[model samples]
Target chain A: MTTMTSNALCFGDEFPASGAPCFVQVDGDGLTITVESEGDDGAGEAVPFSALTVSAGGLDHDHLVVKWTRVQGERTLYLKSPDVIRAFRETVPNHLSLPFAQAAEQVQQVRHRRRLVWSLVSGAILAMVLGLWFGSDLFVELAVSWIPVEWEQKLGESAYRDFLSHQEVMKEGPAVTALGEMTHRLTEQIPNNPYRFEVTVVKSDVVNAFALPGGYVVVFTGLMKKAESGEEVAGVLSHELNHVLQRHGLERIVKSLGLLTVAAIVLGNQQGLVGMMNQLGVELLTLKFGREQETEADLTGLQLLQRAKIDPSGMIRFFERLSEKDQGRMEWLSTHPMSTARAERLKAELAALPKKSPEPFTFEWKQVQTSLGSQPVAAP
Target chain B: MKSEILYPGAFPMVRVDLAAGEHIKAESGAMVACSPTIDIESKMEGGFLGALSRKFLTGEKFFFQTLRASRGPGEVLLAPTVPGEIVILELDGVNEYMVQKDGFLAGADGILIESKMQSLSRGLLGGEGFFILKISGKGMLALNSFGAIHKIELKPDQEYIVDNSHLVAWSSTTSYSIEKATSGWVASFTSGEGFVCRFRGPGLVYIQSRNPGSFGAWIRQFIPVSE
Candidate 1:
């Protein structure tokens, strides 16, 4: 025969006794009991009577009612079902207690707190990392600006002096002479600029061209051969001049030197500026104008051509030719490339632009294109 | 650089680079300016991130920006870059003629030749950047880096191999293929061999250099790495 074991029912934790407390538990054979009682424990010990009434013990109507009185120290529990009493007496152990449930709830609360703390700590770390990445240079720039004004000037002067010395390798020649002439013509055409325009053509044939702040336009011999006529050549030159007139070149220079400006304040060194300039040159070689910049140049250059009355359609046509030619050289195109679509778009604009002829200005391009003939053309 | 009032009375074309903090004041009736895009290689000394950001940032772009000089549409700007070339040609009947080389006008009307010999000499030798062969009776053709210029003649149902770069220009009536260069051990034996573009007959192909120049290669660089 199996020996009977007793089980104790738990009522979790005690409340402040704001309302009537109830206890619920299931008894064998499709039966349930819900007892409502007062905190005073005046209810007497419940007695088992019949299966139906005992199942509804203390249920308020036609159900078993039990009452017990407590003086001041004893805890009271209300039971209504006979099966619950039998199960408690036969199987549930007295050690089976509600304190264990309270302990588990405490454990869950601690875990939640730990998760919150971890999240906050990680978030702080992420903020610090992002701040260091994007804001450090800005902070440095601000700091450098606060230094004595004289220091900034001295640094700029030193950099300028060094820049002049570094360019000693470049020589003046027929191409240079032609470029200078072109610059003069350009400045005269667009007469209202405050700064004077200067054009410099380097002897190297790297097929490259660039515009500098202070109105400098540089063209390499290699790029000259790439052009077949004065219009194409002029188109290339005018584009750079547009950058100068638009002050885009200076903006680039300023941005390049921004880091050095900050570095100067910290180290107070003359070398930083030189380093910055050298670094800026490399960046320029690979720098691809953003889509917007390219689009603006296309639009602006088209306008320049229209105003100049040089057939802005030629610009779009030129772009189409380049795109067709450079299909195999996409890497170069990626770095310094334009698409047929871009050209087509420009053509559309040129076509849309009101066509007007301007007073004749002579393009002595023969002299310029021929100038490169004497100097051995170099590889682009 | 040169200045010319193109046609009888167009605006003056000025070739100069405009620096930052620089502005050109437009007169009441001045026309637009046509010039090349800005080149920074000859100007600045270094290539820093800040410089790069600024170079890209300074470019002007718009879907349609108009420059007004009191008189409507008097000022229009056109800026194209070099190391890159732009040519605008006029088609006169069946004869193909060269109009503008780069952005300048080419004086002589060179004979339009259809001979593969000429294509071979020009395409392989790297004379002109790339030939834009505008055939009188046929269509336009683009040559690629050094390779064979294949001509696919078919009366429906034939095959041919054509590298994508070598695909000068094609008639709309042609099916194409992009496939691996080899299969099995043969693939390993061939160096730099894979993904050759193929095509069927009834088309013309122009071939130039085998290896795409720096620019072309870079465009596909990211794709293979990602794959």
Candidate 2:
């Protein structure tokens, strides 16, 4: 029974440039639009509410548009006032208001579905990254187990010859004899060891040592000069020797070969094996072991020195000293990344082992240092 | 200006005869030939940003070629890039048309072409793309289709379902939503008719006889691929 009256614009069949201004009255069954012109009396056009199709219109969709058919053609009316639209919605029958309500519900559903899809996609990507991270490590271990030890020996021999070709190797000297004694003691302790355990002493000012794939260990004279005792030098040799025993260098190379190349090698592809061997010599010189591999070598090296009856404290003491003093200058520390946590872990491990008094080596440590000429060889 | 469709079925073209100083806007590169008196100039119809949006958003041409009979009255022939039929629509000021991308060929001076965005569901799944051409104002508008064009007039509240890819244009009075062609999602894709537009009308809907997507996929098998 309530009548809502508001100003509106009516675009007739002709759709004139500007719509004619009209006064709209909402009655029980329909809307009566009366055009306010000079000669037109109170007689207005009455359109049934059921006959109108309401939708949002205007350039910015700010106005409510209602369209319906008439005798001449289609007619459109624009309601721009918020009050009129609210009144119209409140007064219109339930069936007439259903479409607007349905449209609003559809928008809500779309936004909800879009948010769900985004979360699912991001979660899938995260799962894939985690899967690859853990899965690749297991895959590398499986592939490395398939490689023959003789092939590793050949790979290490080639890499060793290539490295010594570029450096001044101390072929015979008191430093070589001292290093030989340490290598002999370490290798004698290994049970069923397959490697020949060849150790080379290179004359250089950089304190560094590395082990190749098979049992080739390279020691720099600078490391010998830096050692306070023969036990310290033996400590470093045992750590490098563990790197060889664990096949850490080969593990690094196999990991870098990626999934496809490792699969090929595991499947007995001779071409892939030959291709990898050709690149191993160059890759060996620059390869840096992962932190896990370093920790493994550290713990296992302590056990090897324990079995050799050489003091295990020498190895931990050498690493702890290098980490604190001239950390940046020592190439060994740079490659090893000596953290305080590593030193702490090593100390805890040494404490757990049974007490044993280690015997000192026969050679004098100072004589070995003095035997290496002090010209200070440039770092290569 | 007066326009007529020549070669009505396949390989159809629009021949527009212009009066002095009268112009017709056609899709760029649509003109096959023009008389000596007719001067051709390519212009971005609704300024730089408008044309840029139309190009990237709706996949329409960046520029529209305006053929003006500057010197005197002249005739010009225009054709679409593909071989298809051309339909001419007479637009009254009252009703507007929503056209699929690349459906427009040429229009008289009074017709205004602008890009319009549809609702989210229609834009994402409709296959007609997100942005479509909104043709309004009063003039003759020529539309080209990949195949024969069919016109259907529906009474008020009448419902008709159209395959999304085959749709050409429809009157603004009609409301449509995108849905799967069949009731089931798996069946819709297996039936080779995926998404469809369901329109309720008191207006006209234009559809083409062939689907361009299927035709391209058909031809792709015959082409040799190199490794």
Tens digits of lDDT, candidate 1, B1-227: 11222221112222222332222221112223522332111212123442343233322111112222232212233333322221222222222221111212111112132211112222333222223222222122111122222334422224565443434333222234456556654662363543454544222333323334434576677776654
RMSD of each: 39.7, 9.0
Instruction: Give the C-alpha lDDT of model 1.
Output: 0.40
* Tens digits of lDDT, candidate 2, A293-326: 9999999999999999999999988888888777
- Candidate 1, residues A1-380, lDDT tens digits: the string is 02212111112123111112344343333222222333134332342222222111111111122222234322223343456545543433333324323433454554465557656866899988997688764554454444443443333344434444555334565556555554555455675765555555555545566655445455666566555444554566667667655544334433555655445533655566567555554554444555655676667766776666565554555455556664332332453467666777777777788868733335465566666774422323
Model 2, B1-227: lDDT tens digits are: 78999989989889999999999999999999999999999999899999999999999999999999999999999999987899998775545778999799999989999998766567778778879999987789999998899987755456899998999998765678778988999999999889888886546788999899899999999999998
Candidate 2: segments with Cα more than 4 A from true spot? A1-45, A48-207, A210-380, B116-124, B172-187, B224-227
DockQ of predictions, in order shown: 0.00, 0.12
Off by over 4 Å in 1: A1-174, A189-194, A245-269, A309-311, A326-334, A358-363, A374-380, B1-227
Q: Which ten residues in a row have the lowest lDDT in candidate 2 chain A?
A: A1-10
Worst 10 residues of 2 chain B by lDDT: B89-98
| Fraction of native Cα contacts reproduced by each candidate | 0.00, 0.00
- TM-score of model number 1: 0.33
What value does DockQ give for candidate 2?
0.12
Scanning candidate 1 chain A in windows of ten residues, the lowest lDDT window is A54-63
